[model samples]
Target: MFSICLIGVIPLGTIVYILFLFFDNPSYQTAIHIFARKKCEQRANKNAPYIASYLSCFLYEVIKKNDIVDIPVSDTSINYSGYAIRKNSVIYRFITPVADMPDVDEYNLQKILQNTVIGQLNHYGITGLSSVYQDTTTIVPSVYIDRILYSEEKHLVAVDVLYICTSKDLLYYQNAVRESNNKNKAERTVYDDEV
Candidate 1:
């Protein structure tokens, strides 16, 4: 009798788990990803900054692993940041502060930036990437927002970079900067309409 009950419960549990994985709150996924990465990194390395960088890298890997975006090769002829695809119809041109730094010998910086971008994109539910192009010659120490566009529309949406010094702090900074910019844009639109 006990064995029969256990078998029945197992199937029910499996179904529930699958449902949660598919239909659970989307924000929960981000929180879970961030928390798990933070805990793992904290355990492996006590250095806060390094842990943060690692978290960024881990997040980038997650995005790539999940097939969220494609990384494009650099073209010397084009004098701008890198390009990426979204929704199979949108292309994004992005530039980062470290894109043009000769001093940036660290191989992991690119990965960190990729993850930061992925996290932001996922938060916005933007998917289907064509390619990612990168440029490292920007003036900002942590800027990424040169331009983004829907290929069909050919219009720029926002200009800002999601800056993250520590993995634990990435979400906070992203939200703050993004929200501020959005608010400013709204005000600008209102002012323009008045004019």
Candidate 2:
């Protein structure tokens, strides 16, 4: 009798679970959407390095009206409000107020800018490219979007993206020199030194 009752309960539980899975469940839908967005971000990150080299080559001409003359470098921390523009092999960094997020079309434009920066760095013969999304906020920029495809339930926020481009060869050579001399390993830091 106990075994039969247990079997009956298992089927009932399975049936309920199936119903929840198949039915329109808001919580489940939200979870799925969040998971998908994360996965997409991960895939983008993985492909970033491979494309950075190609993108950096065209960054200067791609980013329009860049007149800044120096690369913004921070010895202590990353700069969030500034953008780095590459002209030929020289990179100019300038600090400005936050730029607004582009609309869906502008988002495409942003992708072009991103690809351009990555490619320009690669053209400099730098390797090991990485980009990180540091912050997302709902503060809208001055730019306008021409069309809206789908409305988001939550206000869409602009993201702060940080890109790192460095040379593995130079790093390895420096490390080897330090090791041969039996000196303490130098602390690795990102410095946007003037080119």
Candidate 3:
């Protein structure tokens, strides 16, 4: 009897999980739309490295125009993967995988940005700008652009770029990071820097 009950519950649990995946939260969907426009851009036909450099420069301009401190650094790789600094400490990184997600469309990408990063930061009252790279495989393609908010102290201290991953996976990874950060906060006490 117990074994039969367990088997029945397994199917019921799976149904619930599937429903949650399909029925996304509305705020998250809206946020992705808001950021989508600025996140997709076309890349130039130069070598991958050159294209990457161009993106960094483009992102720098956006950051600077928004009054974010720019930390200059040498060029790294290209093709949707690179990093930049702000005020010498905060770092932002971007990456695109060789392959795309199975179910993701333009709409999904837009939703991810709006709901996940931009919406969350806006809630915290941090504002800044963003640039998007599209079809980086080709030179001279459409790029997405937008403005975002990043606080001096709380914005993107560090980021690890990922490619070809689902938006859900990315959010789950971020949630884990948030949880870890929360745990760390309790382990340390405040200290005066002057001493």
Winner by TM-score: 2
Return the clash pairs for model 2, or none: 52-118, 55-119, 55-120, 56-118, 56-119, 56-120, 57-119, 57-120, 70-93, 71-93
Q: What lDDT tens digits, residue by residue, belong to model 1 across residues 89-123?
A: 11223322222333222223343444565555445
- For every model shown, the clashing-pair count is 16, 10, 28
Q: Write the per-residue lDDT of candidate 2 for residues 24-133, one digit (tens) a residue.
A: 78988888888987675564356443443333322323343222312122231222222222221112222222233234443444444445444444444223322221
TM-scores vs. true structure, each candidate: 0.20, 0.26, 0.24
Candidate 1 residues lying further than 4 Å off, grouped into runs, are: 1-38, 41-45, 49-176, 188-193
**Error at 44, model 1, angstroms:** 8.8
Between candidates 2 and 3, the one scoring higher on lDDT is 3
Higher-ranked by TM-score: 1 or 3: 3
- The C-alpha local distance difference test score for the whole of candidate 1 amounts to 0.39
Model 1, position 171: C-alpha lDDT score: 40
Which 10 consecutive residues of model 2 have the lowest summed lDDT?
140-149
Candidate 3 structure lDDT: 0.37
Cα lDDT tens digits for candidate 3, 1-195? 999999999999999998787658777668776566334321111233443454455433333333222322223311244433222211235432222232333333333443443333334322222222223342211122222222344322122322212233234444544665686678777779845
